[model samples]
Target: MRIATGDDPFVVEILPETPSTNAVLAQRARQGAPEGLVVVTEHQTAGRGRLDRTWETPLHSALTFSVLLRPPAEQVPAERWPWLPLLAGLAVTTALREEGYAAGVKWPNDVLVAGADGDRKVCGILVERIEAATGSTSGPGPAAVVGIGINTSLTAEELPVPTATSLAIESGGLVDRTAVLRHVLRVLFEHYADWVADSESLRPAYVRASATLGREVRAELPGGGTLVGTATAVDATGRLVVTTPQGDRVVGAGDVVHLRPAR
Candidate 1:
């Protein structure tokens, strides 16, 4: 499928340069922009990864973009909002696998490919929630700004970190940014729409494409604790289920570091 350039459900806006696609779309959402607004930039002066870390890629070397989502409360329960990023990760994993790349989802929203050292990250996702106004009986809404950044054409030296690899680097110097963008959007939107209707089909695909499963992991929890165990599965709500010594536990948010490769 070509980029959703025509009159389609998705309204894709391309920019030659921007500080961050998420920033642009967040402003639009506050201004009452409709759902399905996608902002893709060729360059980002202030791109960010999870936990507010900086993510920089050379101009035209990556697919950097954000999509706006306003999930209806009546259709998607509030508790399921955390699954948005996980679903997006699954979509990207599927798209890359179709392109003949051995991609896998690393919990929450990281897409990774195995490397000589470990699982090198190729994609990072940040999902920001925008809360609705208070004291309005006619209100119960929040928009999600889903930012996806993928390393496409970066050379080996240009990688942001030793644990980061680009598609060009991993695939022996062949990559297509436009096709990647189109495939990503098509898969993401299709799965997202279907998920909003049922919210049940995501886990099976995610589990199948996961790199964290069946591996020893140490999750750095957000509350200043760490959970170490084998990542056995992902529950229906997309939380990682770990078989820790304290018994089976579910981690809703964390930075998971795989201590061993998937068996």
Candidate 2:
């Protein structure tokens, strides 16, 4: 199906298959691809998620794509770059909720939608930074490849995990993949523009839509320790702030598991 691009900067390229959309975009970024270019594939042979995890889905059962972004460091400070993935999660969650699904963003990258069993993961986001090749200095400084995967038409039995879900499963029927893609991309681009203009303005809305905030959680740190606490907030620099028994701890990178409902 055709992805309509009426007066938008997005140039969508659809491939029947690929190793990974993010990988493709990263290569193009290193070669100086423009912002708003999107690469989509029906199946990912080597899909990747955060924490170097494998993310695979049956052919034609998911919406997988990556968008190239070249946010100028002057317009948006380098320090605020971490907000890209979080803003993306907010964009996806907002789009799904607007489509009539109960959606909220889980910290640092996953989108959760309420299901009969519980809040199951419906989408995953991964942002990768690619610096320009040596002596290139062609266009922008560095580029960011934002990869997003959404479970669209998979059946319950076909789900990758019991805690994962698809749009069709939640809606109890078929879904129009093209329409969903268009809606999500539009929202995502809007958020991207808003973020470039003023990153701080996006924080309140993101906090309100966060499913992890005020919830008891366990954060698995990158270097090997774990922290159990109440996820108080997502700080200005996009780190997860957990209020533990010892005190408040800031986590810059880690996997967060929701241990209890939001308080």
Candidate 3:
């Protein structure tokens, strides 16, 4: 029951249950909580993902947590902040790889593990930027709350969708949730540190760990539109670049579906 943070900058608060760790941490951030405040819950009644999708899982069967970060705008630059979710995906992918799973990022934030049928998502991430309130002691800067959910002990039948999976199913046995959580936090901290030093250095590593690159995809763009093409690269700004027949199009935000390769 002892969760080891090991002298990292993190201050972890483990709750028995909660509605959403992100919500809790965002509220705390607005109340002037320092960076590296982590909120973890054994059960999340209302977890969410990108595009406002809701996810629910059995109690104590997943890793549900959120990290509060207040990266200095002078050091990280506001424009470079879009890469936080992608960086988190890379960190999770690296951590799961060390656990003997073939994990890779599915652009923006989902982490997928290669399966016999295809790649199945084992983790999802959501990052939200909270603006500072007027006259708040937290300063005029913004804070980011990074929420992460990883399916650990769920069985095959318990998966939310056909394309979803759990570490237990992949490993054929129960995996230690605390160990997984520790490893992920360690890697995420290291990745975050490196990114603060050099943001561009993160791009190549993410591309290498990305399952979306070098594949055909359909991106459901915002405002009722779509773009289908081969996913080529993640540009300098962390947007997805796709090569369409008309020309190359860059997607800043959208629901991307990996399409089956054309014959």
Candidate 4:
């Protein structure tokens, strides 16, 4: 896919390969790099997914990149900063649907297609807050590095696990990586800018594209345990509301596995 000849959407820096684009940008942000800077590498050897898990992809077969965003503190509350990853997830999910893959997010921001076994992940989002050195959450509101990885051409054999998938695997062949990346970035940036401007609910669109909601799920809660229930809804604050036998619980962080209801 060809990037058009015109004003670039963001300042993009491309490398043949790298250990991790997020790592590169994190160091840059510490040195006072301005926002709108992006780093993309053809291959990532030490890429990290949520929960510190390693993310690996074939060289040149995916869009492995990170973009920096310094949302104006006055506009976006620090507590609401969690929406960045969700925003990125929604962007990728919409992009895939446009490409004819039935894509949706599995809470927070794991992009996947529903399958007989479970949701087969095609992308993962990791949003890191750029915190103050004094270990305080104050000051410049919130800075974030949004890392997105999309598998464009990985075959079934190349998938890291049976639960993982790719556009090639799902679409039956290679997709235009450049085209996919362009569309996703466009979608993410636009939605982000709109949110920063209006501070409204992105939850509606997010809820619509979420495969997690309305399903019986088993969530691996952060502190060490599990919560079993049906994902009833995603609240305005982006929390997953699960209706368990105990009560309605709002999950802020966890690994959710969509489960098939017992027959």
Candidate 5:
């Protein structure tokens, strides 16, 4: 596909191959790259996920990119961090549906596409914060990078798991990667702007699109703790409100897997 120029406000940097788009963008941000600069690679040799897991993408067959944003210092609290992933997921889901693919947000950041037998993960998002220098008490960091990976043309054989799929596979035809990328960026920018304006209004849409709500789940916590619960909802701050066996708990960070409860 021909790369379009001057059509979007953001600066798009396309690379043939990168170790990791997220890592590259973070390095650039540390060196003072401006917000809205997007780094995209046709292939990622060492892509990374939230917990340092591997994210593999074949050359020129998927959307692999990272967007840089530096929100104001006052708004850099933990409560607002989840908005980055939420907005990114919303953008991708909207873009897929616009292209006539059935898609939804599997809680946290995975994009689930409806398959013939069941739902499969088609996209993933990872958001990371760039911290300030040591011992510097000057508020939050300078930048945050949100990385996104979407399976566009990969066949079932290329999928990492039987529960994973691609937009092309789901549609039974090739999809326009450029079109999907454009739509996702546009949607994300719009929602990010709205989030800056008023976060309250964006909560309902996220809740509606979230796949974890009302489902039983097993969350593997950061410190090797496990919580079995039913996802009640996501609070305004974007934390998962889970009703655990002990009681209700707000999970700030964890790997969540939806579970099928016993009959």
Candidate 6:
């Protein structure tokens, strides 16, 4: 597929290959890239996730991009940083639904779709912050990069897991990757602007699109332990509230797997 170009509002840069769109954009932001600068690459050699997990993508088969946003100084609280990924997931789901697929968010960042027997992950989001060089921080510095990856036309054979799916697979045919990417960006910008104005309104849409709440899930924590619980709710700051065997616990980060009730 040929890389297309347009004189859009945001500075959209398309490349054939990059180590990772997030890393590249972060570097540019450190050097003062303007807000809303979008970097997209056809292939990512060193794509990474939140915990440095490997993110592989086939050449020209998926949407691998990152958007840079520099919020005003001390405008957003550090605790609410997770909202970036949450909002991005919502945008992806909304874009897919507009393209005629049932899309839902698997808490924190993964975007899932209903497969034949269960839900399958179709997209992943990662948000990263750039610190200042002064060695002392009092407020927001440069910008934050929200990186997104969406499976557009990957066949079943190309999927990393049996339960994972692509837009093409879910929609019964090939999907236009460019169209999907453009729509997602548009939705993200609109919602992000509203969030900057007033983040409270995003809660309803996020809660409605979330798949973790009201489900039995096993959360894999960062330090080497697991918590099995029923996801009860998502707090205003976007943390998952899980009712566990011991008690109710708030999970800030984890891999959540939905469980099936015993017969």
Per residue, candidate 6 scores C-alpha lDDT tens digits across 1-263 of 22333644466788889989999988888777778889999898788887788867788768899999886656667766767788888888888887788888888778999766888889988888886546645444768899999988898889988878888888888788878888998888888888877768688998898877888887766566777778888888888888977899886754443332211
The candidates, ranked best first by TM-score, are: 2, 3, 1, 6, 4, 5
| Clashing pairs counted in every model | 0, 0, 0, 0, 0, 0
Pitting candidate 3 against candidate 5, the one with the higher TM-score is: 3
Residue-level lDDT tens digits of model 5 in 1-263: 22545766577889888899999989888777778889988899898887688867788878899998887757456567777787788878877787887888877768998766877889988899886656756543667799999998998788888888888888888688877888888888887778877777678888877776888877766566677779898787677888976889886654443332221
Task: Give the worst 10-residue stretch by lDDT in candidate 5.
Answer: 254-263
RMSD of each: 3.0, 2.2, 2.2, 3.4, 3.1, 3.3
Distance from true position, residue 21, model 4, in Å? Answer: 0.6
Select the stronger candidate by lDDT from 1 and 3.
3
Worst 10 residues of 3 by lDDT: 254-263
Runs of candidate 2 exceeding 4 Å displacement: 1-4, 254-263
| TM accuracy, model 5 | 0.88
| TM-score, one value per model | 0.90, 0.94, 0.93, 0.89, 0.88, 0.89
Candidate 2 lDDT (Cα, 0 to 1) = 0.86
lDDT of candidate model 6 versus the reference? 0.80
Itemize residue pairs with steric clashes in candidate 6.
none
What's model 1's overall lDDT?
0.84
lDDT of 2 by residue, 78-190 (tens): 88889998989999999999999999998876899976667899999899989989897566679999999999999998998888999999999998887888899999999
